[model samples]
Target: MASNFAAPMKVIAAAFEESTGHRVRLAFGSSGKIFAQVSNGAPFDIFLSADQAKPHALLNAGLAEPGSAFTYAIGRLVLWSPVTGRVSDGPGALREGGYRKLALANPRLAPYGAAAVQVLGSLELVETTRSRWVQGENISQAFQFVATGNAELGFVALSQVMKEGRIARGSGWVVPSSMHRPIRQDAVLLEQGAENPAARALLAFLRSPRSAALIESHGYQLPVSEE
Candidate 1:
């Protein structure tokens, strides 16, 4: 659904294909975009959303089977800067300091972006940092803004920054979940004949213990899911 899901899901999907000999094709994008596609008849058999809202929309629209959707992960946000070995410890840094361009995902579309807004507001940086704010369509793009130095720094997903089994390269702060609402990312099995053998295999394999373990290893927390 965002940068956070990309690497972890890639590793797990590859391993699943290796073990089960069941190949999987992936579709990745902003949760909002995916949701729109799914609603308008995207060919995908399953929807893994960045937040619960989109999947719930699918379920409510009868695009997904009742009770077939559930929270798959809990996302965490981060404050990342591209500079190597530099870390932005916390929200306070954004406030009592100066940065010309700061990036964040569009809060209206991305839950992590919304949380970043909350963290800033809680720290009283909204009014101070508002003028400096720049928006990405998704968290990955937001991370890219900071990663490529397009912006001085930005709010990103913790999972995206995790590299070589580490959280981030540059100076950044892993925002505590308590600072914002839980990002309950959900996955739904589509009801529009998406229940083909391949789809079932993919779904089953995603919830497999090995897959869950791998995703967790990449710094994403798997939900107590019944998917």
Candidate 2:
């Protein structure tokens, strides 16, 4: 699972375990890192990527079961700050330019980071803000950087600071989807788990209405077809 999905996946996995008696052991990290590990024969049964590209790459490389990959969630990006009004105006706050450090995941290792880069480019702040960056290896760490006041504000997954359509703490501005490509997160059955009933069952659970609602409560959108 990608680190951005950490909170929701944990809850979903626990619910699946309780209802089906199937224990799910999950490992979360940047999609890029996990993709490399999967390609290198990491012993993972499933791949829940932060983008469609990685899963598609795995399928093309014969690392994942053909036809098993599909979008599970559409992630939202947000400009956030732990301070009450730091980011209330969204990109406007960024444009105001008083903050010393801005945190974001490393674009090479996380889809959210790639989106953050896109957002910066769209806002025309790339050159001006690039020097103040505090890059995290993954989105979780980026969020942590802001939450701990290491960075005044940063780009993070909306799911990290939201629950049930509300910001859980601090302030945030949901980035407009038009600013970047849709964050279509995909999930696939790895070749290693093609014959694993538990893996298959877990995948089925992700597509269930139960999981769909649970996913939305964490501030993610379902694929249009599911919606």
Provide the overall lDDT of each model, using Cα atoms, as 2-decimal numbers.
Answer: 0.80, 0.93
lDDT of 1 at 14: 85
Task: Identify the candidate with maximal lDDT.
Answer: 2
lDDT of 1 by residue, 1-227 (tens): 44569888888778878877877778888988888888888887878888888888888898987887767678878888878544545766686566788899999988988988998888878888998899999998898888888888898888877876676477778888788888888888887646587667777777777777777676677776432
Please report, as a residue range, the 10-residue window in candidate 2 with the lowest summed lDDT.
82-91
Q: Which candidate leads in TM-score?
A: 2
Clashes of each: 6, 0
Indicate the TM-score of model 1: 0.92
Q: What is the clash tally of candidate 2?
A: 0
Stretches of model 1 off by over 4 angstroms after superposition: 1-3, 224-227
TM-score of 2: 0.96
